[model samples]
Target chain A: MTTLLVVLLLAIGVYCVAVLEAWIASGRFRLMAPACSAIALLGRESIVPRKPDLLFFEMGPIVLLVAALLAAAVIPLSPDLIITDLATGALFLNAALAYVLVALIMAGWGPNGAYAMIGGWRFLGQLIAYAMLVVMPITAVAMRAESLATTDIVISQSGLWNIFYQPLGFVLFFIAAMGLAFLPPFDLPTAKGELAGGVEAEYSGVRLAVFRLGRMVLVVTLAAATVTFYLGGWQGPSLPPWLWSAIKILLVTAAMLLIGRYVPRIREAHLLAWCWKFGIPLALLNIFIVGILLVVIP
Target chain B: MITAQAIFIGFFGVAAVWFGVVVFRTFSMVRSAIALLFSQTALGAMFLTMQAEFLGVLQIMMMATEMSIMAFFMVMFMMDPGGMGKMEMTHQKRLSWIVGLASFVGAVAIAVFIDWGPVATTVAETAEQTEALGLELLGRSMLIFEMAGVTILTAMIAATSVAIPPMPSPEKTHKDKV
Candidate 1:
């Protein structure tokens, strides 16, 4: 029952993200554009490149989708509405997201194209850059929550959200999450102008649709995670808990999608340099401050 | 709970062993790395089945990223990375087999011969276990942990320094041009 609900929510979230992304990219607000696009994408032929690695090609998008779903499963919509409330929910989310690099690498190498392979390599570098930023913020959050469970993280923010308590961590986590989702600015893996769609260049038809869908799901999951970790998830009064969760998640998703369009895509070297130089130190500082705050406040 | 754990343990243990074998059997470097990843992931699952949630999740998370990175390097370095030529994956096969069988025999002998200690009577909840583990790390195991962390950081720095080609100074460039 919980699984069905979570899957349904994810499906809805993905569609909403698709719509939101389209609305941001284009000036129009057509609700059905995403559905139309998916159908059109499916109707097209998926042509495999000559001498492709069939296994990598076949598994790339599916693995991506599976990884996103696995991460989403741990995230709670409301107190009672969680899928499996694993003790290591936050860590599991990070772990599941680590596979995004693998999926991108597979997608890049599967086609046996120079552009795709370079795209994959670019993401590997990106992973090395953003990986610490991603985990360190979570470490601080876990420290604050006194548990790695996502729900506890959310509940711990009842009095004061982490965004306010640890603003540095919030900023770092938000930027890292954007990189994780590979949103524009961080979208080096699929930078269309440079790599000619890069990793997504070779995929077509149903496969392409799956890749895009997985990407949308990933975006939604990250946005949801941001809300859960920073925005005091489901803590708003006068609104139902689920409604509060929904509102926060969608607003976050929209913000994430909208922010990308305004910022030009970043160079890989700049991204890495900024993350390592500025992001990691800030994250460590955030952890230190949070640790001190926890002691003083307690 | 025990039944479920046993079932999952059996399933994942077999999967881990099978994938471990596949890692060696595959000709492609990428495939070999991925197989090892699956093997590690299955071992992580086995840890979960043993109710070591923190360790299990950490293992899975760490291994996935590490294996993918390893695969990337293997593809870059290895000849016939895609296994198009079906090159032999094994080297010094007879020696490897002898080592493998001898180790296997040694492990089995130790398992059978040793008078094992009493089994743990009570199991801790995942959260409690995690907290306890954390305390141990910060208390008894802090030295070892910090040592490992510093060693890894040193190695990473050394590797980067080694891999990067040093740029020639402007004076050297001018001298060359002259």
Candidate 2:
């Protein structure tokens, strides 16, 4: 029953954030936008491509949604609200989220179209570019906490949040989070202007809705993770832990959406080169510095 | 009466084998990759049932990313991208089946006959287990791990160099003074 409640709250929170971001990004102010949009989506019939690989085409978005949910499972809303407090919760989240790449590839390839194929390939490129940037900072955080568990990491931040100590790591992780969600500037795979929805081009009705929700779920999960790792997840005074975590998640989501709206999309080549050349090395340096501080400051 | 763990193990074990079979039999490279992913996922589930949470998630993540990369290669090379066209993808099927059967028999025989050691006397808590693992890796095998990391990085650098075709020397322009 507790698990069910946690799932319900997570769904509601993520859905609200998705709707809020949509309204902000488009500058649309219909108060009932989220409900109306969902209703409109439900009424449309899902259309499959003529030569589509039926199994993969259908399973792709489901895989994505499942991945996001699985990743979210490891994050605690409050001390008492954690679904599964696995020892390796932090790494588990990372591992589950990695399935997003596979789902994107399936979405791109299953349609059997040039545009979808390009989009899929583009996602792979994004994966290669941002993967190291994502992992390196997580490594540093794990190093500081001296444990892979998310709860332990949060505990370690009781004295001082990790962001204060590992600000560079925080910055690197935030940028990588944007890339992970395929938000604007890093949204190469589904460039609406160029590939016309990219991997999701062929999807419509329920299928398209699933992909959109999955992406939004990813945004929520990534924000929650950032809060958990850097912002001292569920840790605060005066208010309850869950409420603190929820507020932090909202702020992070708003920031991500605002950045997505304002930042111009970068050229694919430039983004890839910059990530590999500068971002990864900077992350490595952050890790090295944190490691040194941990050893010497102790 | 079957316990939940037993049922879970049995389901995932069968699912793993089923998907493994689907992988080879699928006509399209993309389908094969996705089938392989399902097989990997089932295998990961089996790992989870054993309480090896870290290892299970790691396996899933690694295989997911690896299979996606495999799909990219398949798309680049496969002639029948959609699997709409039928093509003969196998040869000497009878002999191959004989070999496969023999291998399976050998594996089963080994499993049945081998005298495995007793399970650990004391299974440490997960957090302690993780600490021990970290000690084992960083304290005892630190040098080896570092060496392995360096070797892999070197290989990656070599691969990138090899994969990138050398830029064509700026086409000798007739206008350029020799």
Candidate 3:
């Protein structure tokens, strides 16, 4: 069963990569067609500039791909089907995500373009801003779950999903995750109008294809994590367990993509300020509320 | 199910060989920095496998981000983009190699000398682990930690704004100079 689950995860990862490649190449996924056309109409071209170093450009996608695979090893598909099942599953997930900064820096520096370099620095700034906010909410959730294992967190929500009790934390976490994932409104580092392709302006061909694929896979992975940690993964009735899990995951992914496509972008500094101000405070408030509820409600 | 010890052993073996190759084959400072970042990531993974959850997260957050930033700085400051130039691997290299070998030997020696014994079973099962963690986090201490985190963030933002270099005046334009 564990072997089957691992294989299934790998297959899904590969499928996500393929879909993203197809989308980037044709700029016309069934769901993303409108956004692609709008972007096209805006006169955005995916150009690869001259004399870019190949190694750095190529490494971005490779690192992202490897991170996704390693992250999968820690997620549980069923009761007994995790590859690693470390006691510190939350830590493992965060650790896996830390690879993104490295990949982004490599992509930015590898291209040897001024815009890409600036984008890279901006991304680092974004990382510092969002990471602090993201950690608090996730850590709050982890503490509320009492154990770090993915399955353990899901089971704790057997009585109630954390979102019901900690909506503020959920919202803060969702926004921070969106920023980290470079979703719409928060994708300042990659804002096409101002920074060309942001960190990836000089990349083309298979390199661009791989990075695009990695982005999609990361989207799916982050959505799955949000579900697993907060929305009660595979806990619904009237369906097989795995199917229920799939439904929840798809719903989150759809919501993420919808937001990514439709929302207007915010300036990088403003976005950081928003996170530091509203996001962090709300996350802290939720933690306090949860603590009070735990003490008084029983 | 593999024991933590076995996992540690496997990771140590792989990491040893990986770092060995990195030290031998890396020709430039930038490549060495990148190699160090990857090695640190591997170490963080090993820490997770060892069930040191907090430490693992800290390791990943600090090491990975710092190493990447170092790599970026090296590229920006150094003239060579590819880092293909010859590097000085002198007395520091020998010291590092000796220290690494000694550490490896010391670790193996400790593992061999320690007595093997039965360990107490964990109270939380795999399924219950996440729930227990959630419940634990709901304690009052976590709230205090969260508050401290916010305060620290505020200070950081304030410092950042103060440190940024101000934009130059428009009077120093090319037209005026001409």
Candidate 4:
């Protein structure tokens, strides 16, 4: 069935990214390193911390993974390959992804450790920075399409993708997507040197794997959404729509990882200031421009 | 066979009630906040079952963000935030119970007795429904909607200004002191 294939592709996409990340982290860009790492991890014992809130600690990673999958469900792999084509698919994706914040907080707070607590609260700061960055551009895109449905947004790009039109919006969205996924420069919540893995300090073995995998899935979902909302979901010439979707998602993921590796980690305070002072105002201006263009042209 | 909508409504209805109870019963402030989120999420799912997709998703997203913030604030302020001591959080035990039960009974009575308006004979498709709602808001209620948005924006700015901690005053130099 189409649904099963969509799920399979999503899983594989996340796996590929996770592998790529491990390769980067281990100082080796070998292809088989991630698989070997996974095999080794399978034998490790899952550890639960003492004096921790067990319920929330256990629920966190599962919820994060569920949220990622739920967000991905709304994305159309191709014209006929969507899991659920809700009228408000775009909004639903946003809503589902918002819960990732909750899961991160739960993970951070439940561990009852200084590093975990600090990491958890750091994500809140990250959310404050990137939340509007994600929403404003999506709103502008919806305005251009005059519809909230992902399918409709894609259709409006039959001639030209919104990326060409909403260049500023695309740039803002790209940065925020990375931030939301906690990739690279925005990975303050789990900064290894400073917080000793931050929200992930206490997690070990299977739970750790689940949490790490979920984070990768979050990256994959964000990339897929970028392709869906901006690059035009499954719209391409001289190739199958599903293949096009795959290619776009992979390209976006690679770009995020590449940018993440090259960029130095940003200070939390500086990032927050950048978001509030520069990002928010620019996003607002982009919206104003988009509205003017829409009215003037349409 | 039972319809999928009916099944989903039943599931979410029970989940909403269960989590609502959990919200008050939980000893930990963080747990209580998350329980409240679950309760809201279940209600949102119920709305989805009723085909109010936009409202459903809005409810889920808003509650998730709000509850995440609430949980953070609770941890920052509340003592024994992890509930290590398992402290009881309830107050006004007997009087509050009586008041709650009485309010619940009154709400049920009102719900059962009210002569609600007749339901629509037919419902529009999802796209048409959303389009119509959008038009209604932007076309007729445009002024009020925009005003409300502006009001919220102003409130946000005010809150941010108040919330940001004051910067430390510069220390006076010996020359300035002299």
lDDT of each: 0.90, 0.86, 0.71, 0.88
Q: Which prediction has more favorable TM-score, 3 or 4?
A: 4
lDDT of 3 by residue, A1-298 (tens): 6767665764664464445444544666765453454345345444555755566666877887677666666766556666877767777777787777777777876676888877777888787777766677777777677667788888888888988867877787788778877876777767788998787677665666667657766777777778777888768888876666667766676676667666788987788787778777777887788788767852
Q: Where in model 2 is the C-alpha error above 4 Å? A: B1-6, B120-122, B166-178
lDDT of 2 by residue, A212-271 (tens): 889889999999999999999999999998899999999998899889888899888998
> Judged by lDDT relative to the true structure, which candidate is superior, 2 or 4?
4
- Report the Cα RMSD per candidate: 2.0, 2.5, 7.4, 2.6
The runs of at least 3 residues in candidate 4 whose Cα sits more than 4 Å from the true structure, single-residue gaps closed, are B1-7, B161-178
Candidate ranking under lDDT, highest first, comes to 1, 4, 2, 3
What is the Cα-based lDDT of residue B6 in candidate 2? Answer: 77
Sliding window of 10 residues with minimal summed lDDT for model 3 chain B:
B122-131
Model 4 per-residue lDDT tens digits across residues A172-212: 99999999999889999999889999999999888888898
Alpha carbon lDDT of residue A259, candidate 4? 90
Winner by lDDT? 1
Native contacts matched by each model: 0.86, 0.80, 0.60, 0.77
Report the lDDT tens digits of candidate 1 across residue range A1-298.
9789878988988888888888888989999999999989999999999999999999999989988888888889989788988999999999999988889988998999989888988998898779888899999999999999999999999999889999989889989999998999899999999999999999999999999989889988898899999999878989888889888999998888788989999999899999889888998999999999999995
What TM value does model 3 have? 0.71
Candidate 1 residue B66 Cα shift, in angstroms, is 0.9
Tens-place lDDT per residue, model 3, B17-113, is 6964784476644566777876776776675566555565668767877876676676667665355566544568878989989998999899999
Best by DockQ: 1
Measured on C-alpha atoms, candidate 3 has an lDDT of 0.71
Worst 10 residues of 4 chain A by lDDT: A34-43
